[model samples]
Each structure stands twice: as C-alpha cells, then as structure tokens.
Target: MSDLYDNLKRTVEDLAAPADEQEAMLRKARVGPDELALDFDAFAAAALNLVESGELSSEAYEAVRALDAHLVAFSGANNAAEWTEDALYHSSNWATARELASKVLSLMG
Candidate 1:
C-alpha cells in the first residue's frame, strides 16, 4: 500500500520477484563506502505502522528509532560485522514491541 511496504514485499519475495527488482532491493540494503544511511526502511515502516495503529506507546516507538539510529550510525563504517550485530539488536526491541502489544490486547479485553 505504501512505497516502503511495496519495497519490502519485493524484498521478501526474493526469488519470486524479477531478477532486476531483487537485485535492486539487495543493492539498496547492501553495505558500501558510498552509502550514506542504513537500509532499515522496511523494518522502520513496519514498526511505525504498528505504532500508528495505537498498539505501541510513543516511548516504545522511540526505542525502535534509537535502535535504527544505532545501525544507521555505522552506514559509513567498513565493518560489516558491527552493522550486522546492530541490525540484530532488533530482536530485543521486538520483545519490547511484544510486551506493548500484550498490554494493548489486555486493555482491549
């Protein structure tokens, strides 16, 4: 429905997508010296969507932003391993999201 969603879907589709499109997604998410920012576009969009849905608190949203920033800060760095570890930090943030989601569902019930 949105550009980020479309781009993300194409990425998930991977082998099913046209070769050129898949390559494009990989290129966007690829690490390189010329890169100016991390490619967390899909992850950020999905997280914001949930926050916009009123399922997560603003503080939780900020936590996600912080994690994104942590990874983005390494955009210009040459170490791929550090970038990957920062990206993996999403797991802990997802746990926070799950806790928020549970609270929202409890309130709903």
Candidate 2:
C-alpha cells in the first residue's frame, strides 16, 4: 500500500504539474466567452480514457464514484463558497479522488 501510495502521488504530481502546452491551451480556452469552457465532462472523459487504456486501476473507479457522490452533495448546497470550501478541504469525496489518483499513479509507475 505504501509503495502504491508513493507511486500514485508521484504520478499525480507529474500529471498535475502544468506543462507549457497544456497551460497555453488552458489560457486560450479561458480567453473568450464563445470559447468552449472546460467542463467536468471533459475531465471525466480523460480520466475514463486513462482507465480504459490501463493507465489507471479499478481502484480509481471506486474512488471516482465516491468523489462524484460528494460532488453531488456539494452542488446541492445553497452557499457556493461554503460548498467550495467543503469540497476542497473537508469532503470525503476529495479524499477518495486523491486516493484513486494516487493508486493510478502507483500502478503506472
């Protein structure tokens, strides 16, 4: 578990680190009102693709499921700021997502 955890953490840090091309693309994507805004669907698709490609393990799927439940709860809240705070700092969903991501990274390594 520790080996998996460490590997997963390294993989996520590498992937999450903004590369120049990705950064530029994100900047461009955010530039115009007409530009297609980044959406959760796109992110989910990418993650799913990783799973399909064998880059991520089945553990990631479980984590994502848990995270989605948390996101649903967060979305139902009235206070947007509070929801954001909870999602980022206090939600079990976020923890699950992190755990999944780490597991995936470990598998990749």
Candidate 3:
C-alpha cells in the first residue's frame, strides 16, 4: 500500500487548509476534483492514459474511475462549510474520492 489512507487522513483532519495545499495533495496522489481546476477532463484522461502507457495498471484505473463516478454522481452535492480559502467547497464526494483513491493506492503496491 502507498500509505495514502494515512496521508489522506492527515490531510483531511484540518479541512481548513488553504486550497493550494489540498489541491497539491490530491494532484500528488493522482486523484480528486482538484485537477478539474486545470482542465475539465484532465484527471480522467490521465488515469486511462497512465493505464494505456502501462504506468498505472487497468485495475488501478478502475478504482480511480469509481472515484471519478462519485465526482460525477455527487456533482451537485456541494456544501458551503467545507469551502477552501480559494472558494471551492470540498463536497461530500471528496470522501468517496479519498476512499476509492486509498483503495487504488493500496492495490498498486
């Protein structure tokens, strides 16, 4: 496992970090809506591309994709309280993203 759960557990504890830190963590893990800020389909495209390049296995992509599905499913379930300093709410989908990201990270190694 990549210790992503532990890392994420640590990250989520504050839930009030500046948006940059949160986004950095998500990008470093190659997961979450944080990437959507850079490009609409960037996150999703990267996973499949990684799989295709044999960088990330297909199994990992599926787990990542499930997280993406949650991002899609809960696209409207925004909450005002979790908004980072940058003004983007973390959303309930973040939990789902983190859970699935942890699973994918665990499986990879």
Q: Report the number of the highest-TM-score candidate.
A: 3
- Candidate 3: C-alpha RMSD after superposition: 8.3
lDDT of 2 at 79: 38
In angstroms, the error of model 3 at 31 is 17
What is the overall TM-score of model 3 with all chains considered together?
0.48
Model 3 ranges off by over 4 Å: 1-41, 77-92
Query: Which regions of candidate 2 are displaced past 4 Å?
Result: 1-41, 84-109
Count of clashes, each model: 0, 1, 0
Each model's TM-score, in the order given?
Answer: 0.36, 0.39, 0.48
Sliding window of 10 residues with minimal summed lDDT for model 1: 32-41
RMSD to truth, every model: 9.6, 9.0, 8.3
User: lDDT values of the candidates?
Assistant: 0.42, 0.42, 0.50
- Which candidate's lDDT is highest? 3
Q: What would the per-residue lDDT of candidate 1 be over residues 2-101, giving only the tens digit for each residue?
A: 5644443332233223334434655687743122122333545476675576655566556545544544554444645533323333434333323433
lDDT score, candidate 3 = 0.50
1-109, model 2: which lDDT tens digit per residue?
3433344344344323333433354456554211111233234434555567665666765554444444445453363552332333454544544554444444445
Model 1 steric clash pairs = none
Better model by TM-score: candidate 2 vs candidate 3 = 3
